[model samples]
Target: MEGFDFEKIEKWWVARVKDFFIGKPFKIKMDLSKSVRTLVRGVLSQAERRQKDAGGTAYVGAVMQHLVGAKLELFLDEALEHNGFSVADAPTKRNGDFQIENVVIHVTQTPTESLIQKCVDNLSSNLSPLIVTSHKGAISAENLADAENIADRIDVLEIEQFIATNILEISRFARESRKVTVEQLVEKYNAIIAAHETDPSLSLIIG
Candidate 1:
């Protein structure tokens, strides 16, 4: 007990009790920046809303699209420099959410017949079609691709898997942890949106 500071310990405990009733001081080593946190929180909020009411599916879907689009853009910029290709948000009228060279990437929370058809259309137009959807949607999407006889021509990818793969690649290239790399990419995304107004095709309107 000679080395112990009993009074300091008591004060700390009292402060903790008060904080429990009111609020703790703002102090956190953020894993993500403010803008990125807001974007992620918005997506999570939409997901929660969807859980409460299936009617929020459309809203959640849109948020997922934007989130995926933004992340893909950052990944492409970092990964494609030596590949002679670049990724960008597709126009509203396009069949894909993103375009990379001759490849068209369609991002969805879930795959549907309509999405499959859009991929087929991309193939018909001589563009390589890549479908990025949730892991739960991958199998069904691939089945739809096979049914349409486009499985050989199109690539179906799981969103989480794709992100993991790219994150590893980025971490390797930067010699950093995957989590840190993700935070860096998000910071880059924030800078991009700040420099140029947030690309409408890559941003969601959550009201």
Candidate 2:
């Protein structure tokens, strides 16, 4: 996959081995960053039971950053990679994200023109992508218009939505393969991705 999470390589995040997930996506992100900033300040964020300063201090820049970082690391990394999708940013995966065959993911908190143009260029170059945004609020009119203009440029799927949508398959594959953990499933899939990506001739063993 093109959008190999930089963490995937850095932290030995071979998917299932050391991977972690709470019942909620926000919590997972908070755990990864060790901050509850997003929970306090986000449009729909709520503090976990453990955070003492998580209240009344929400809506600060740190909060948004909390949301962005968590959303990117927890949900974005897990969901996209599980599907063997590539991100634009790999090795230095933050620059873009993953590339799965034709699909790519560009993680962001807001959809900027520079980002959109990059997506356009990538798409024209034959990379299908989705924009992962940390903006939990409804789409702005401006964003809506731009999104329409380049709807085909790249997709934009929220991090939370993606996890809820795919956790089932994650669970299913884990059970089927006797991996017994999300980390294991992720490991299997990512290995499959690297193998097929590096040598299409090795496709037979991937399944």
lDDT of 2 by residue, 1-207 (tens): 677877658656533332232112222222223222231233234232212233332222222333333333443454433222232343543435555557665554455677766676676787776765554521532375376487644566664554333443444534332223333433443354443344221111111
lDDT of each: 0.58, 0.41
Q: Give all TM-scores, in the order shown.
A: 0.59, 0.41
User: Which is the leading candidate under lDDT?
Assistant: 1
Candidate 1, residue 66: CA error in Å?
Answer: 2.5
Per-residue lDDT tens digits for candidate 1, residues 78-136, read 53211101233343366576678898878776788988888878888889998877767
Off by over 4 Å in 1: 1-59, 78-91, 173-176, 188-207
